[model samples]
Every structure is written in C-alpha cells, then in structure tokens.
Target: MMLSHYLIVSGILFSIGFLGVLLRKNTLVVLMSLELMLNAVNLLFVAFSRYNLSLDGSIFVFFSITVAAAEVAVGLAIVVALFRLKQTVFVDAFNEMKN
Candidate 1:
C-alpha cells in the first residue's frame, strides 16, 4: 500500500533475482530472474505513481510491460535457437557468442 513498503518488496525481489541470475547456470533460470527484476521495477513505478497521485508512473509501467512482453518473445526465441544449436540450456555453454 505505501510507497516504502512497495520499495522494500521490490528491493528484496530484485536482490533475489540478481542472486538467481548470478548463481544459476541455466538459461531459463536466468530469464526468469530477468522477469523478476522487471516486475520489481514495475511495482516500484506503480507505488510511486500512487504516492504522487500522478499517471505518468502507470504510463511508464504500461510501456515497460509492453517492452517486457517483446523481450520475452525474442528472448525465448533466442533461447530456443540456442538449445537447438548447443543441445543444452546452460549459460556456460553459450560459447557461440565468443569471438
């Protein structure tokens, strides 16, 4: 309800997501972490907007959701391609991008 509460929740979620992204070797887990971070940011935006009684934060959140949807589409496609090529989903196996 309050902005501080939302911020604290978002901070915790972001930290957890960051840890997941750092510790997980699986591509899927990494992507899920990314989603977690995005959702945390969205929550912060919405809470700030409500606190300020303005619509801009909500508008930005809307755009962020749109962008996140597009990212999911492209990210999943790329992951699928990686799986087909590497026969694995481990992030450490992603050597194709190396020079």
Candidate 2:
C-alpha cells in the first residue's frame, strides 16, 4: 500500500500500546505494551525505508530490534525477581520501592 497506510497503522498500534502501558497494572502486561510500542516504531521505520528506497531505516530497525530484545531480557528478569520478592507483578503492589 502507500506510506500513509503504514503510518496510520503504526500510529494506531502506538496509541494502543501507549494506553496499555498507562492503564495496565501488571508488570508483565506493561512490558508487553512496551514491546508493542517498540514494534510500532519499527513498523514506521520500515515504512519510511520502503518509501525512500533506502536501507538506512531498515538498518536502524535492525539495531532497534536488537536493543529491544536485550531490554525484554533484562526487564523480564527484573520482573521475575520482583515477583519472587513480593509474590505479585502488579506495579501498585511494589510501592515499597517508592522510598
């Protein structure tokens, strides 16, 4: 399709992901939402790359995916550790960290 179509889809995905991150209480869900947001950005990058007929955006997308993978690994590990300590993954339940 056209670049506009891709942009619209990416924007919608980003909005949904943003809302998910803002409204969810579970840390796991939040992490997933964050990934959703990242993917949306990746989608935009690829769309622009395709439109411009250049590899730069695709290269950026590759690196973004790599970084996102690392983030997921570290984020999940932290979530698991927090769950072990508190027996819950809800962000509200970890108010002890507020100090």
Model 2: CA > 4 A from native: none
- List, residue by residue over 42-97, the lDDT tens digit for candidate 1: 99998899999999999999899999999999999999998999899999889865
Which pairs, if any, clash in model 2?
Answer: none
TM-score computed on alpha carbons, candidate 1: 0.94
TM-score of each: 0.94, 0.95
What 10-residue stretch in candidate 1 is worst by lDDT? 1-10
For all predictions, the C-alpha RMSD in Å is 1.1, 0.9
Name the lDDT of candidate 2.
Answer: 0.97
| Each prediction's whole-model lDDT (CA) | 0.92, 0.97
Tens digit of per-residue lDDT, candidate 2, span 1-99: 789999999999999999999999999999999999999999999999999999999999999999999999999999999999999999999887589
